[model samples]
Target: MTRIFIQDKATFKTTARTYDDAGFLHVPGRVSKTGTQQYLRRELGLDGDPNARVTVYRPPEEVFAADSLASFDGADVTVMHPGELVNAKNYRKTSVGLIRGPGQQDGDFVKADLVVKDADAIAAIEKRGFVELSAGYTAEYEHSPGTTDDGTEYEYVQRGIRINHAALLPAGAARAGRQARLYDHQPKGSTMSKITLDSGRSVEVQDEATAALVQDHIDRLQKQVTDAQAELDKRQATIDGQAEQITKLQAATADDQITARLKAVTDARARAEKIAPGVTFDSIDPVEIQRQALAKARPSTDWAAKSEAYVQAAFDMAFDQVETTDAHADQKRKLAEDGAKVVTDKAKMPAYDSYTARFTQPQAKE
Candidate 1:
């Protein structure tokens, strides 16, 4: 495994500071924390595609171990990381201070005394120019997957941590002192991850946070599309149901109309039979049958020039005249039969001929 260089920023008890006549300032502070830290793969200089990121774990045991803490004792201090391990060759040029006391575990962090011997470094600290410390160290990276107690997932764990130096950096240079070490030599853009867009384009987003936001937006839009499709399906089903109902209603209406028409034609044929017996009216329009009836009822009149209402009235009068003439003929026949019976009988009740003449009257013209 290649040795990986890592940096973690520190927080200090700035109020508990002291200065000697030689212009050296000593400050005690917590340097690093035990947790999982995320870093781009390129920052670790590991053999792989460098655009990806990895989460590394620094367990409490490894962070607060006796050997690891002791390595910080007398460690070189620089204004910023020298982009390489601090060794005897670069010690004179890079060192502005030193880790003065034995390093020890403090709560979840590692605490040590940081002494600034360089006047420029002390002046920078006094002016709040150097507000934080970043610990430079080399460690063996054990590639594995694990989760922290707080459910933070990590892909690698740091082992055999050896402190090389502590760099005093400007404020906000590092947000968390977590253990995934970032290589100081990498460019600032190394912290970003490349995200592919829908247009076959790619954009670099800052690590995980921005990427998560983009994913959430995509998920919400997909849900909206699904919901819209569901609504459309529901509406289509309703329309189809209504269409089926309309078809059934239309069929029923047609059946009703056919029944009504058949009844009207049957009624017209019955009337025609009464007016002109033995006349077939099948397959004839009712209006035409009515016209023929009117012509028969009024033979001399120009019935073609008459309105339908006038024709109907004349047909009705003719039917009434036929009913009256038939009733009178039956009465006369009965009277004649009674008179003949009287003539044959010896006991004459009133003479039948005389009785018939008194009861029956002469028929009138149409």
Candidate 2:
């Protein structure tokens, strides 16, 4: 991307457009001669091309990619150059690893270089993508109508710029690493008005089928969790029925198989009692005690008291069961969210209110 910068100076502030690619400074309004030298050195900080001949104050001729370049040969375009300042050129040279190379010295330079390479200037040139021409004078002879004046002579050569960068053209026209077709003519000014380059565009393609696949996996997992919970509920009901008959058995009245069945219920109850943080499970309610007593009551006159205790036990068991299911449901909900089954479609996913409304929400999306 070409960045536009506005610079101001004393003796009349003017807008000079500079581009990164072409190492040129486009200054409008007769650049004040008094400050022009300092302006080129300080403001534009242009050094002549390594093989260029022009100084910073060297009058810049408006040349295009097709123009010949002869006078500017060996010209090092520099904002500043070493040893050129017979007086003062104090640009801090970061001497961190100066001589770390095969043909270099220690405490040398990085941001600054001993000899600025044409490759470096070309780097900036490629960024702006300009065609270069040599700047030499060529003489053209013409007969004077009333006076004896011969045509002026000039020397020039064809200049080729190493392309730094160019904007891409849409519709598979222009691309990088491939030779770009050139336009026939050179631009008039240093900067042209809305002239576009030929280069490619990039885009991301997503298929409708991909989104559908994610939704399918979400539905399958939710169904598995739902089926598991329903089956668990059915098993608990069966255990409740068997526990009733076990309460009446005394000593060896029932077989060992019945005893095993009763133990299963106790074990399940213990598993459900695992307390969740922040939730109190120590308190036992009357309802749960009555339910347990009723399920374990013997065939005797104390059935009422036994039923009361059973109800209290039932409440505690119910609390634990409820907690477990809630945890499992939360886990499933989070899983669903990960799989795109979020809760409160309007709040989580406004796009899926209708379809996901029937399914549960995942915890993660929340």
The candidate scoring highest on TM-score is 1
Off by over 4 Å in 1: 11-16, 175-366
TM-scores for all candidates?
0.47, 0.14
User: What is the Cα-based lDDT of residue 20 in candidate 1?
Assistant: 85
lDDT of 1 at 178: 24
| Tens-digit lDDT track of model 1 for 1-366 | 878888777533123367788868877766777777667788788668788878888888888888999999999889988998898898889999889767777666677787889988877776866757788998878889988775557899988888888888776655343221211222333455555555667787764434534643454465557868999999999999999999987885797877987887777677766677766543556666766765565557777787878777776676677678878999999999999987678345567666676669675779
Query: Candidate 2: minimum summed lDDT over ten consecutive residues — where?
Result: 103-112
Report the lDDT tens digits of candidate 2 across residue range 1-366: 211111211111112233335343321111111101111222222345444321121112212221312222222222212322111233233111111111111111001011222444434334533222211122211112221112212222111312111111112211110111212222333322221112233222232222223333343455557868999999999998788767765533667856776665565455334322222233243334333333343223353455545545644665667678889999998898876634344566665665666587654653
RMSD of each: 26.3, 36.5
Instruction: Report lDDT (CA) for all predictions.
Output: 0.72, 0.30
The TM-score of predicted model 2 comes to 0.14
- List candidate 2 stretches off by more than 4 Å: 1-254, 261-265, 268-272, 275-313, 316-328, 331-366
